[model samples]
Target: MSRIPEIVFVTREEIIDELWNKGIESAFNSNIYAYTWYLDIVSPGWSALITDNYDYLFPLPTKKKYGINYIIQPLYCQQLGLYSSKHITPELVDTFIDNIPSKFKYVNINLNIHNKTDKHKSDTNSRVTYMLDLLNYDDQIFPKYKENTKRNILKAFAKNHTITTSLTPSEFISFYKYNGHIESPAKEIKIIKQLIECLIRQQKLTLLGCINQSNEIGSVALFAENNDTIYYLLGARNKRIKSSSLHFLLDYQIKNRSGLGKTLDFEGSMIPSIAHFFSGFGAKPCKYLNYTKNSIPASDLILRLKKELGL
Candidate 1:
């Protein structure tokens, strides 16, 4: 009989060798969202469950609400769960989930694409994301785009809009604040700025903007890439643009990045129109899991009251 490995909970300062070797060695890279520095920016108080050998890890982004410490998904983090150096089997996922400390009574989070399991199927909901494979050249990849997307790209070009990759982090943040209509807390926006600056320093960030002849910003997007994948982290468009500058901006990236054997992860949209827009670019749906459990009394009722009262 084989013995199951023991898992221990540790605070942010306790991480020793760094998960994924601080995301240096590509051989051990799992997800950029799970990187220690990324977590520090997004969720400063993050902790984790790990084996003694550091083969596997489960990040817990926790917060204290009404004096109750609970796990909640942090802003700007798309997915985080069992990130391991070894094969992430269903059994391994269950083991880490089961070990989540009981102190975190209310749990709601998203697991990465790799953390597949049937054990929590009843409590988990499916979420959709979109990814475009960029293994082929621009000429080959352009044809795969749906007619609607192709038309939009043409429309943008007809308007003489140009794509620029020179937007600074603060500039993007200001654009997002004024034009993006983002509803996240101001503090979260600050965190995003910090994250963007950090990524820039690491040379992992790609900030692109679409500009008109008059040099007005029409659309912009921020992408973070590892060696092989680019995550469309955030984007915004000028509502006044009559043409499809956002589409033009994305198509520019597609053309620039195609033939590089990479993937473009459209971080996601559950809204039908947004999802359709992503699919129009030949992006395929990628499903992840959303797990939620509330053991606290009247939690839902309290949330409902807060929503009703506009709290």
Candidate 2:
């Protein structure tokens, strides 16, 4: 809900390059900016996209820029499956908007507003992220945790298993295998390798791992660092180490990076179990904006019709 700082307004190319370099963990990067930003071009109108990602800032016509009450702005939200970072607050939003509409405006932020039944529940609120503050990852707090979670972590550590602090040949292989279960498998393994290669050469790669004696147990990769926060990119645990050791591993890493930030985000988890795991770490749930907009009324109607037709 807070406005992110260090707002850098850069061109689209720069944003992509920066994201590619830093491996920014955002779905909004490609869909919203790279693709949707072009909307203003094809369909010219007075619209502006403000973001705090520091990279994808579009320099729009300042003269044409008038922040209409969001209600009447006729602006659309992008519906990228990724979480949208919030750069504007009610205050900032107010600043952007100049002409105050005289009429009372009734707008709602209810998630799943358009969908009903199970369909809405599936992706009910697509714009929230779960952030874990590293300070929340304390050794003293671990003992007071759940019994099952506590037992597994200890079991894995006691298994005399191989745990590698840094991902090695074995860990890399396991990480990918585990990720295959996700709905959107990240770019092909080859692409990820290439991306990581580019990241490391540029020193943008922030990789961490935990292994049993020699067996790889858990690992995560991230980029971007300020004095107060660490943005998580990719993290996974070895099913073998499904033991609480993964918790210990992540906890160790969170503490390991406390210098860079007050907390470590496990990133947003769509699955309740995973979300619950992050919550167990005493992490705060954060809400960001995920938008989906359509063309003019006619065009938008057509799009909706197409969806129903498909059904």
Candidate 3:
């Protein structure tokens, strides 16, 4: 049995080895986004809250804006919250929320799917992601795909578009920059490049691409492996192409990885169209919460009073 939970805030540099060991060895929430090296690339200087027994961990990615400290969820980090090998009760979640340092006057963070609490309903917003269980063989899984998804896959095949895994980090970055519809800032793109390099070094990256008959790269995707799950970290495709290369690419992954007891996490889109695209592959929606709080009343009053007093 573990000791009574005593949560403590830890700085980024203070508990690196211990925290990462626990993260890999014991944490029940198996998300790559929570790992030390992954967090370092996307959310540098991030800290955490941990229980005395190291049974629970919560990453606090903070930022200071306009001289006020606040917590903001980092880019490419889909879900992060209480991670534990033990059962996470509502009360435990509340305890962690309550312990967030008061100096952070504002908070905006996303909790993992395993967490649930009624205590802070007013302060939380709902978010959804899609996940596909790949325990069944491809033949068994194919029947469950939406008809449209199947049609797209067939269409790509008929067009002679081939799936390829011979993509480099630099090639994928360039493709994404020019063809992707999403607005990725230069800094975020740079971080993505660095992350790809790191993942490649660890041999944990699955880079896939769809090539057209003309031998042009039309679509590309990057998936990161952590244990048995694969995260669909990022992807980009040419909109001008008539063929659905993304459909072909993801179907290729599902086919090869099926019956392997693995999961594919489509690191998500709340937009209906995008969500539908993911669901087409028979992926199901998983819900999580985003917590937000503002102690603006008290802080604003204090500021005004100080300003009026001229010191």
Candidate 4:
């Protein structure tokens, strides 16, 4: 007979050491969001699940709304589910889902790219992110880009748009917000700004901007670095620029970071147009899973009301 792994809920105090230890051993756990300091700032009071030997782990970033406790995917954290040193099986995923404490009443979170599971009762939506392998230098990589992307890069160069890494986090945030890319509320923006500041302090932030010949900022992007991957966290561009300044900016970053053997992760939008834009850069699609469950009696009604109120 085979032994079934026992899953137990761990308090906050136990998280830092164990999670970091496990993360160090697992490539998938290398994300900065899974780190203690990052979580402390972005998702304080978070709980977790772990096996007896601490081989498998899951972080539950919970929040209480309207007196109902639920697990939420925190801002700036891309994926947080099922980090294990051992091979993860469908059975293990199902076990973890089944063992999630009933107190949460509701759950909605995105699993890591490595996670896979058998279909469950709750909704499971598919999400896609884009990634470009940076092993090749510009000489070899540029040809892989779509023709339209190439044209844009050439146009940007002809327009004398220069790429610079001088933008501060606050400046990048302001540009992103004013460009109408992020429609989040003031409170949410505050939280995101705090996260950005924390990442900046940790030396994990990369801010780049494209300046046109007239010395105006035409495009800006903020990348978060962790575990040999540069995540395209946020970006915005001035629509008035007929030149493809944004395209040139991204290409410059990819080329500049190429020899370092990092992957550029376009933490993406399932929205068709955005997906198309990422694809133009020769980025491949990486599909992940978003899991949700509502166990409360009136959970549907509550969710509906929240949506209607834009909460």
Candidate 5:
């Protein structure tokens, strides 16, 4: 029987990318790479973030415990080799951990679905993140959500709202401006543009657009589809979208794609308000570890020295 190959470490630009590519190939979200790159732009530290996604390869910061991590990329990683730190156990993980330069206090976070093989559980010390499993999945459709979501969706439908999908820059801008999804979404917005461009170049973006006929306010549901999963990454509609039905437009896409994989990942919920927004969709929580080992003393010392010198 062909066995799963041991994950031999490779170049940050090479092996790291293969790993990321593997996850993206398995239907991981495209926006993950952008956030990963944002960290690189914001801090640009000892980020050992490695990934194949050309537009996104950089370190991001974490507000975790006492240390930092070189987050290469974020993903809806399902497979062990691609999007998970599941293989880097306490015993063998040290090798990779030791290689990491300590200056990068930003821990890497890879949110993944829990399967039987993932023996490692997340903790405070690790750079892992939690997950939200989409419930009532069916291969042909998104699973059943709570009554409130159903009503919202029904309301969107009942209003005879016009819905369309796009990855066009104009459309994205429209969506951004319409819903005031512009502010406080710098990293996310930047990545959305990058992903839109990348997917458009590859002809792989399946951006969904919805418009309320009565108000002319446009709602957008941005999604990327692959063989295994469909990620409902971004949703935006103007305040005119009563009850925020644009969320429903996006949720409908998730429900339609639930049965396609073992679990549907609801990216993250850093803010309680946003968490509440995603939670209402009925996905259970999942988490991952953000493991770190400070190997680069020189980098760490330099960063510390710089901070002290005010340089």
Candidate 6:
């Protein structure tokens, strides 16, 4: 009989070092969300589970509501789950899932793309992210773009729209909020702003905008890059010239960032319209899992009521 891998909850003091070491060992751990600095900004009191020697790890971004401790998917973070330096097997993933502490009564989080487990497959929800490999730049890239996307890009060019990276975070946020793209509460927006500032200070943020001859900002997007991927974090546009400005802005970004050999992650929307838009740029669908489990009494009932009420 084989011994079960002993998983231990890491203390606050140990998180930074472990996360840094794991990131250096595992490519997927390059995601900024899992880093201590980023977590400190968005999910302040986060912790993790780790096997001895840090071969396998899982970050648990927790919160307390009405005295009930639960895990949640943090804002601006797309995924958080098992991260490993070695090949992850079904048994390994299952072991990690089973070991999550029972103190967390409500758990809802998106696992990283590298994580897969048959143990709780049915309880997982699916979401698709779009990624474009930038190696096929210049000559080979634009040809892959959907015909409609090409047309829109040309239209923006014909209209003499200019692309610029001079927009500040505050300006972009103001534009995003005014365009009704920000539905988050003021507090959440404040957190997002702080995250943006931190990434900017690290020189990991790219802000792009499409402006007309009249100097009007038609569309803007914020792209944050880590070691492996350039994430299309957020975007907003003025309704007046929404037709081709966004298409042009995105194309310009891909073109400029191409040949760098990193993936462009369309940090996504499950909405059909948004998915279709991402597909137009030659990005393919990459699926990930979201897991949820409720252990608290009445939690399931409340969730059922919320679903019924469409809340």
lDDT of each model, Cα atoms only?
A: 0.83, 0.42, 0.85, 0.81, 0.46, 0.81
lDDT of 5 at 156: 73
By TM-score, the candidates rank as 3, 1, 6, 4, 5, 2
- In terms of lDDT, model 5 sits at 0.46
Task: Give me candidate 1's TM-score against the actual structure.
Answer: 0.91
- Give the alpha carbon lDDT tens digit for every residue of 185-248 in model 1: 4886788789888898878999999998778999889999976889998888987766698999
lDDT of 2 by residue, 11-95 (tens): 3334454443232234223222123232333223323333454332322221111221222211122212212233323333333
Candidate 5 per-residue lDDT over residues 75-136, each given as its tens digit: 22221212332332333333334343454444444433332223233322322222334445
| Candidate 6 whole-model C-alpha lDDT, 0 to 1 | 0.81
Predicted structure 2: clash tally: 25
Per-residue error (Å), model 2, residue 109 = 15
In terms of lDDT, the poorest run of 10 residues in model 5 is 76-85
Q: How far is candidate 1 from the true structure (C-alpha RMSD, Å)?
A: 3.4
Which regions of candidate 5 deviate over 4 angstroms? 1-90, 103-143, 177-188, 255-263, 291-311
Better structure of 4 and 6 per TM-score: 6
Question: Lowest summed-lDDT stretch of 10 residues in model 6?
Answer: 21-30
Model 4 agreement with the true structure over 207-301: per-residue lDDT tens digits: 89999999988999888898788899778888666668899999999889997889999987699999999999999999888999977777665
Model number with the top TM-score: 3
Ranking by lDDT: 3, 1, 6, 4, 5, 2
Per-model TM-score on C-alpha atoms? 0.91, 0.53, 0.92, 0.89, 0.60, 0.90
Mind sharing the TM-score for model 4? Answer: 0.89
* Clashing residue pairs found in predicted model 3: none
At residue 144, candidate 3 shows an lDDT of 92
Output the worst ten-in-a-row residue range by lDDT, candidate 3. 16-25
lDDT by residue for model 6 over 1-311, one digit each (tens)?
24667899875567657545555347544576776777777788887888777666788888876567899998888977877666766677778878888998988989888778788887789988998998766676889999999999999899899998889788887887776365666966788688888897878999998998678999989888888789998887797655589999999999998988889999877999999999999999998889899888897657766776779
Could you say which candidate leads in lDDT?
3
